[model samples]
Target: MAGHATVPSSPEPSSLRALPPSAKLVVKTLEYEGRLTQAELVESTRLPDRTVRYALRELEDEDLVTSRISFADARQRVYSLTTAES
Candidate 1:
């Protein structure tokens, strides 16, 4: 924990207000589903591939989500809400 930076315990309304609707949907999906891959997010959120990708990038920029390589498939990445945001 030494080198890790702490985020606010709750999301800031101003920040969330600035995000696109797709990004908000992605966040809600992750919150409900725990964690999911890009494909899963698309399935769960009914969002297009490109939109999911864009949303993920936006979430990452806000430090609201983090990604890790899937253990079952090296080619896939799974995403989840960060502890602070979760």
Candidate 2:
């Protein structure tokens, strides 16, 4: 019988290290919930509004998350993990 090759079971350390703890939390929330508004993200992460906004901005800059005006309320903005990140 031929032996099967073993596959790596974990993500690269560099990839994990690149994300800050808050960013990780935000990503996880978005991934689990599909889509969320900025307020919702703040609630979900239990983070301060400034922290949530900072994380969202960093994620957006990294192309990890995308945002657009909410159809239900133009005054509000919705956010979600990008397809590549998801």
Candidate 3:
């Protein structure tokens, strides 16, 4: 460990830190509002639907976000952060 640098207990934060700005905004929105549908995320974040979709995909790829069928509407999916951190 002579030349080793310190590391965070969880790698998700660092992984999140490397994500695109749009993805970060989506994460922030979820953190503040908890779970929300794609449309709700767009309305809350004020990001375009396509951008939100892309960001959600990015977050999902990194395992930072999870989505499930919305109970209110099966056509939509509710999204939330996988961890406490963004």
> TM-scores of the models, in the given order?
0.82, 0.76, 0.81
For all predictions, the C-alpha RMSD in Å is 6.9, 8.3, 9.3
Q: Which stretches of model 2 miss by more than 4 angstroms?
A: 1-16, 84-86
Instruction: State each candidate's clash count.
Output: 0, 0, 0
lDDT tens digits, residue span 1-86, model 2: 26643322323345446777897788778777767898999999999989989888887887778898999999999987676334
Q: List the residue pairs that clash in candidate 3.
A: none
Model 2 CA lDDT for position 23: 78
lDDT of 1 by residue, 1-86 (tens): 69644433435567789999999888777776676899999999998999999999998999888999999899999998886434
Structure candidate 2, residue pairs in collision: none
Worst 10 contiguous positions by lDDT, candidate 1:
4-13
* Global lDDT of each candidate: 0.84, 0.76, 0.84
Candidate 1, RMSD to the unseen true structure: 6.9
lDDT of 3 by residue, 1-86 (tens): 78653332333567888888999999888876778999999999999999999999998998888899999999999998887434
